[model samples]
Target: MILDDFLIYNTNGLYCKCGDFYLDPQVPVTHAVISHAHADHAVASNNEVYCTEATAAFMQLRYAKNAAKVFNIAAYHQSFVVGGVAVTFISAGHMLGSAQVLMEYQGTKYLYTGDYKIQPDATCEPIEWAKADVLITESTFADPEVLHPDPVVEIKKLNDISLNIMLGAYSLGKSQRLINLITEHAPQKTILVHHRIMPINQVYERMGYKPGKYQIYGRKLMKQQGGFVYIVPPFTFDSYARAKDVKRLFASGWKNLQVNKQDTLFISDHADWNDILEAVKQVQPSQIWTLHGDGRHLKNHFNNDIFVKLLS
Candidate 1:
């Protein structure tokens, strides 16, 4: 393994000195190589932003004229030069236009996986594997015991319940995925999405992703007794916390989010333990650098087999 730290994490997120750019920077920077359009990763007002086409669109939709001074959009696998480094974007499969940033400088390859998942997602691009010398990964669900159940089976749980369900999900990625899953698995429940989520859904549809059938949310639906699914953002979901008529279910992989709620739908857009292991195998990296979540489990698992460095 190379002795040099190809990438480093600080308050500004992942930085590449060779490239003179930040990878999914927390704060706005002069040159930002965004991995996706997620709020945390793709902040507005960057001088020059580099990302995929879909990511650009989402950013434009969210931040409007403030998205960036210049959008250097690149397709998946296309290599572009930023200072001394050659950068490439690979599909991350977490959400639409999400990518794993691959930076190559002085013969060494470093891959920064920004919120990736290996699970099949119809709403976004599938994760692509590329061999790299150093693998910078997210350890969100790195614990060995945190294996996520099959999403198909999890979504099917909605079919068993015939009540009006207030389903809470993130508007950007999770909501779209849930709509598709419900259409395929729980066809009996009519889909009602919040008005705020409609623009994003339209973006998904225009991008050629069919998220099945869903209508804009209406207050009248809440008066109904059964047979519908009201999909809303977290804020709206929390607002209806006291509504006693509908069954509450939040789709997420985090246990903390599922706490105090009996109806659990364990759906995640991040890689679980086994998926992380598989990503390591696919990347074929000699050195591993973890961030975003706890990396102690990975450090213990790799032990002497591979070098595991926690960036967080």
Candidate 2:
């Protein structure tokens, strides 16, 4: 579908717009606006790119030279114009530097939400809902059957489960979210983190989220903490016997589903079905386009007035 003179294509990339930009003629447009630095969402090769400052730093570290052309914008609501499109950015709450891009052309406003999560987390700002004419959103956890436990409740459960319990999650976003939740809900207890999580923890700290006493993964540190919560990657759980002394919990958006029998905990960064409904009601957009994950399931739950398109 076309909006005004802008042409939207379901290219082999996350989200691409083709118009009056000249940098990457091979792709679609010159001014590429990105939602986050996730490998699938943002490509550093794009000549002129726009994303949050933290995302830019991450891209710079990953693809040094390619990141030089990036234009960094702070996560706090900010507006800028590119190619005659008045674009404003807000936090997506998915990662340290994730953002939702809102573009206004003439009088119509179009909002593109890059993978977002409504549940509050310490790793990033809470997702911000905005009203718009066209709302493009992510449906990563759109099924009603998927329901995440309340952050506070989950933290209490995790705390009471065992002293030497190890939680498995992604090193970047999920780790910080779990750590922050534990800090807020169970501040008295010192948390232990794996060495891989240290870098992202530093980034989160720079973003003003200071976690409580934590220890990085090492033989010496692991031996010292027999009753502390150790946050590690999901892959670590494959060799459960290695951590036999500690109980294990797997945290992810997928945990909301009953597909697995393993001890799964529902702690996700993505918005669940309830979050999607509320966000749609809050935004009240005339048109809604769903992207990523199961969009059709979410589309069926909304009102008929809102146009829904699945961008697979």
Best by TM-score: 1
Q: What is the C-alpha lDDT of each candidate?
A: 0.91, 0.69
| Model 2 spans with C-alpha error above 4 angstroms | 1-7, 10-30, 65-68, 187-189, 235-242, 256-262
Q: How well does each candidate superpose onto the true structure, as a TM-score?
A: 0.97, 0.84
The residue-by-residue lDDT of candidate 1 on 1-312, one tens digit each, is 364656777778788877889988999899999999999899999999999999999999999999999999999999999988899999999999999999888788998999998889999999999999999999999999999999999999888776788899999999999999999888888999999999999999999997988998888876787889999899988988888877888999998777346568999999999999999999999999999999999999989999999998
User: Any runs in candidate 1 off by more than 4 Å, and if so which?
Assistant: 1-3, 259-261
Residue 257 C-alpha lDDT in model 2: 37
Cα deviation of 212, candidate 2, in Å:
3.2
lDDT of 2 by residue, 1-312 (tens): 337334354343443343343211234335677777766676657767777888786667666786646564655577877767777888878887888887777688877787888776766777887888877777877789877678777677665654466777777677887887887787665678877678767876886876556777555555554557778875665556466566677776674332236455677777888888877887888877776777888667664766677755
Q: List the residue pairs that clash in candidate 2.
A: none
The alpha-carbon deviation from the true structure for residue 72 of candidate 1, after best TM-score superposition, in angstroms, is 0.3
